[model samples]
Target: MTQPPPPPPNQPPGPPPGDPQGGFGAPQDPPPGGFGAPTPPPQQPYGYPQQQPGQPQYGYPQQQPPTQPQYGYPQQPPTQPQYGYPQQQPPGQPPYGYPTQPQYAQTPPPSGGKKLSAQAQIIIAAVVAVALIVGGGIWYASSGGGEEKNDTAGATSGASQGKGGGNGVGGNGKEKAPANPQAKLAFQLPQPKVQDITDVSGSWLTDKAYVKTGVDSIVGYDLDKGAAAWTLALPGQVCGASRHVTADNKTAVLFEATKRVGPRFYQPCTEVGVIDLTAGKLVWSKSVTGGSAGDTKARFSEVTLSGTTVAAGGTDGGAAFDVANGNPRWSPKPNAQDCYDMGYGGGAGLVAARKCGPYDSQYVVIQNLNPLTGAPVSQFKMPPGVKYASIVSTKPLVVAADVGDTAGDGSGISDFFSIDEKTGKLKAKITADADRYAARCRSTEVESCTKVLVGNGRIYVPTEEHEGSSGEYGDETNEIVSFDLATGKPMTGKADAGDKYTLVPLRMDGGNLIAYKIPPYDKGGQVVSIDGGTMQATTLMENPSDDSVRDAENSFGTDYAEILYGNGRMFISDTMLSKPRASSSTKEYLALAFTTH
Candidate 1:
């Protein structure tokens, strides 16, 4: 395999040779006057065509400066295109490196669909290998350390409620925003050196501590000081974690039975367990094996929590265990039609994506399941040509899929189907253009989508970042829009990100939408609360504009980053970590926290 040359120093690695150049990168040095500082309007914005001087500028106002620089000022010319703005590709090309066909995981194609030739399969495998290498290289070259903090010595504290009034669990949308929300750097966790790319995707916030998954252990840090309060060592690395946490701060995870050895680089993810976030201990660990294939041990790809049930699903089949005592609830059994549960969605409810029928014409059946019983309450069969379906929300019953391989962007979504879980009937079909909407779902991981959210009977998603009205270099922005779940019609208002700032939907705060604004090179990021009805925005927390802080925040791009905001504090963490480049000097952090108090 031919390796691409390393990117220029401080610059993020670009896409492979035939791939398009895009995605967020490290922050660059701010020009004179600093970001968000007052500046005179330019004669014309870059990229866009020039207009007459008298006409009002399309983006930020040139005459009156913003009250506190809510949105950043125009950035200086970039030696290269900064993050968020992707260069356009020539016509008649794949959007990204992914092939046009819809990829399935551990499953065969539908009866009517064409199968990939042996040669094509090899080509796809090579593409995947190159992608993994490039991905690891990006982290190696782009990672840098942030403001240091003492994290080794501190007394453990009991889980407490967040400052204002809410618990730090699920952002239940009841936490009050501070009146004057000015955030400062709270603490940072230094990245641990690793010999290979490692997965560390889980993080949770509790009133008393912020718990995160480390390489081979889970650590709880004091909320204010960022010191390691307690650590629970594990026998193997965490393979999957549930984003949902119980009311009492209990979550679930899937892991391997043993550590990866020399020739055994890949280990089976067969262990299932529940973690007590408040107590910082693994409550119980176990593994099961069953199903038509009669495998010795079940390897799960995803795990989720619903009420007291810890449900896990994978290629072999599905299993559920009691979250409290790890008692067996149910396991896959031989069925008449050769059906098996591929994955499950849990949080407000428990739903399963079941694949059945013969190999050539296999179709997916979405079932709203009884969490404790593992029985289908109601089921809806997906249309033909739909290879896979992801559950976006279980309560309202929203499923996303790329019908007939038309999404083309590898986002794993082209349309959203709203169904009535009680009746198992389709209510509406929402057509979300892949190029227009920024939401995405992992092709195989049913519950692994981000950037799109469902709440208050509506679906919220951000528009793809486009050229800002400023017409200046690196002035790109986006906004949040919505669609009614019942009718699938466009909603009335929108939350604008302003110029040079990209807005991403984080979660819902009561009737307001909480979002993070990715600023230009010179400015710091901001967390804002947008009114659900009026679409107006309120600044919740603004970060420091210092270079080191900005770099730390920018290191975790919103696309693949895990962001948790609650109790007047925000945490940005990476889902994966890689060995730093031997020649690099910049420090790297596993996670960074900011607080408004």
Candidate 2:
């Protein structure tokens, strides 16, 4: 049987390490200025680099998120109040009261329940104060509703923690001034030959793109112009199915399985191949058989690539290979506990969960290797009580841990910490107030939320929660929570999801954050950017393409909205058109790409 999805590279596969069965309870009153309360400006945590005097503070505005009109999605006035902001009009749309659209279904809460922050009273007071200050005037703008007058709600009242740039956003319900101009679409492209989009990655160094098409082909595209440069195909029949494919500027690694014919029963074989993009050829392919020689069908359950190391693991054990040449480098002993749930540490090398002592003693081990050779250069473990949860990278190696149960969100809290790559020493630690577990799961359904990314020296977390108390159609929350990359403290404010938008962060472009926004039950999605520092957002494109395309649905009825960032550009594609297409040349399966810079 396949092992449960391993937590990020250094993390294990299980409910958080501290308390597996605990239920996250209702949110408690935040400490001083915790979750909902207004507090002093954040003091840079230990190990955080000092900010320059003129550096911008990265935080989300306290005002509720707004909505927008998307391509094909008719412009509709928002009737219900957004999570933290009052209802407002979108740009280019007629004045409010056009016609009310049917409400979409509510996103079910986690099966164990959810904790709405207990800051409702404080929010009400702030809102009332803003209404009074504005004299209850209706401010309008061509871009959308007027800039949120109370955008800085509760940001500045707290005493300055240390020598910093400006007064924090007003804390005592005072309104802070608006920021950067509204966002506009930069550009959009179309992809017609795409049957389905499997993957998309960009390489800034080469200014090239690697994309997996629905039909067994990987194409390289030019970064400047949206054109295919080269295409590679997976040859031969593969037995097992795996989704652990990755690409850098120079090479792409794909995982597949093949069947070995036998006189009695056919046995399965695992294969990992590397495609040299520049040469436009399958450079190398290797078979993986980690278990005993007698066992004919030794297959891997997991596959991942870090640097040049491709690691594959099964319940029995795991192994590593050099992606440049399909040569075996190392394999774990049969049934060895250390080999269980092995994973590639993203750009970091090999990662494994090792049992150190006799029983009940297991430590997550990270091995930074030369990649050229499977030899470890160094290793480290998290401080005690901290269980390995997930990892992002190795240099200044980033990892998240399940620290234990916190007062609120009984699912327990996770800490994203960094380790010194040179010495394997602890460098910094930031506590994730919102549990990754709680964030990834809804009711009994579990989704991957470990895609947390770092950009422009800041860490970001995506959160989706019920916005206002009203169960209205459009008040649900979907935005990103940012933290100091060094300190791991939640930034002063957060990025808001637009009223007509349900944006999910894809990756970071330079210092800016890139995300895909899906309209409520709509076919197409939009590309938007959030200022890395201020958490302000701009819609790069509304519809992205003019052609109508219904979102694709899996057997599970889950909608597929594909948006990827790589090679210094954002790769976006639409699902197949819901209705029959007139011809294949139609842009039903095209990718709309834009240069982030």
Candidate 3:
């Protein structure tokens, strides 16, 4: 799901192929001395490469490269104010923030491909402006919030799995690795000056707090002194959250009922609430009107939490409530082949992704519901061009798609079936290869997806950062590999990420496999643990390459960040929040944490 870095050899040619405000075609403003100082590319170090005099540049330890451009996306001016993905833009582009071309065009790596780095094309233009303004779903459970139910073929029992396979409710719990861990920085959050591109996404981690989701409140912090400790506020603006908490820490969101006004700048995610992350509050909020596209209200874009239900979904459909007292339990009724649900994949059970016929033969069915009778106890149906799917794991029932679109790399995934929720059958498909995998899946957000990971019966995945046998200007690395959800093959072991680092996997910690790593640019991030069998990694916490904490951990770029290691800490946030680069003063952050104690 990363892709964009190819243009570098003589550069300057972008913006023609459908240049509706240019994305890969570069240029959208900020060049001629505006990014607050753009003269650093004469000899070596914007994205590094050009050292033949005596060669020899191996790994880490080479500091000295920051005379100005502190972190990314500055150099502005097309009137300058863009910030992206609030949803609904398509008319001549120009919205999703940062990527105004600061020289790229190195080209040359196609017959074997690998080159990429100017910090990976500024982290693939901030993950293509957060895959075009965040789509939805990405909760994966069982860090130990506990629900442990696996079996429609996921075959549970890797100490009771739950990280992308579900049911360990507000999950994330296996800490214990400490010995030498190393961490430091412990708290940082500042980056709120936003007036546009906002949606602070979400982030959790309980057993004392860490919450986050601010632009209309959720706060929480204080796990080891980051402070705040509780906020919850809300009246509008947290348009969706719910990576399924609830082993008591409860969880569910999706807001916006008012608050934007100037021509009503988007304010209809309806409402649907549930918070309570160990008492940080919210408890209940509701909004449903009718569904089947009728009384109007509905709106949601995604929300989950199984067992006690909650649900939510959108395109004007799917409802469900009762996380303890919001009550409804099911709504959105009208059906008759118009089929609407469109999103849902809560932990441990309850799947959905419906979207049936009509808009030009559109398909997508995948049911398996019954989280208190939303009905369909098993379905399937996707095939035929598949406009979208992405479930990733409803008890081994995985899904992900992009099929006929052939994963042109916007990463809705290019395949990963594995069904069998009792009898929906199928079981093993796999096929990844979106330029050698780095899993993604938000094409339309049926539970979003990222670096993928379904547990023990195997799925893992990582691979895409390439180029690293160490010198010639070496160091880029990446590797996790696993696949074998019953027999889609390849799985003898992998884990790597060493050289300049990049790993990412972040879940499943019973049979082991936690991962995070990123580092490089003078080093610091890590979290390791691997060994789901002997993939062997183990570091646990690391963080702190000093230089103001590696420039705030390289400005949270692991594809639109949010990361969240457990116990021995690690947090990192930012799901989009623009408005600081009037030509760089650097200093930006919305979340950060690290610990090791």
Question: What TM-score, over all chains together, does every model reach?
Answer: 0.71, 0.52, 0.31
Give candidate 2's error at residue 80 in angstroms: 54
Weakest lDDT window of 10 consecutive positions for candidate 3: 19-28
Q: Give the worst 10-residue stretch by lDDT in candidate 1.
A: 148-157
Query: Candidate 1 lDDT, tens digit per residue, 1-597?
Result: 111121243332222121111111000000111111112223222221111011111111111111121111111111222111111111232221111111111112225556656666445444543443344345335533210000001000011112222112122245566977879999999998776778888888777898888988899999888999999999998999887777777788999898877543568888999998889989999999877548788889999877788889888788888888998777766555566788888776777887776789777777766676564555566655678888887777889887677778888888777777664556656666666677888878777777776765777778778777878989988777766667564554567899999988776554456788998998889988766655668788888889999998998878777887777888888888876899999888899999987
Q: Write the per-residue lDDT of candidate 2 for residues 78-115, one digit (tens) a residue.
A: 11111222112111222111111101111112244454
Better structure of 1 and 2 per TM-score: 1
The alpha-carbon deviation from the true structure for residue 373 of candidate 1, after best TM-score superposition, in angstroms, is 0.5
Stretches > 4 Å off in candidate 1: 1-173, 292-295
lDDT of each residue in 116-145, candidate 3, tens digit only: 556655454455433323221111111111
TM-score of 1: 0.71
* CA RMSD per model (angstroms): 19.9, 18.3, 24.7
Question: Which ranking of candidates, highest TM-score first?
Answer: 1, 2, 3
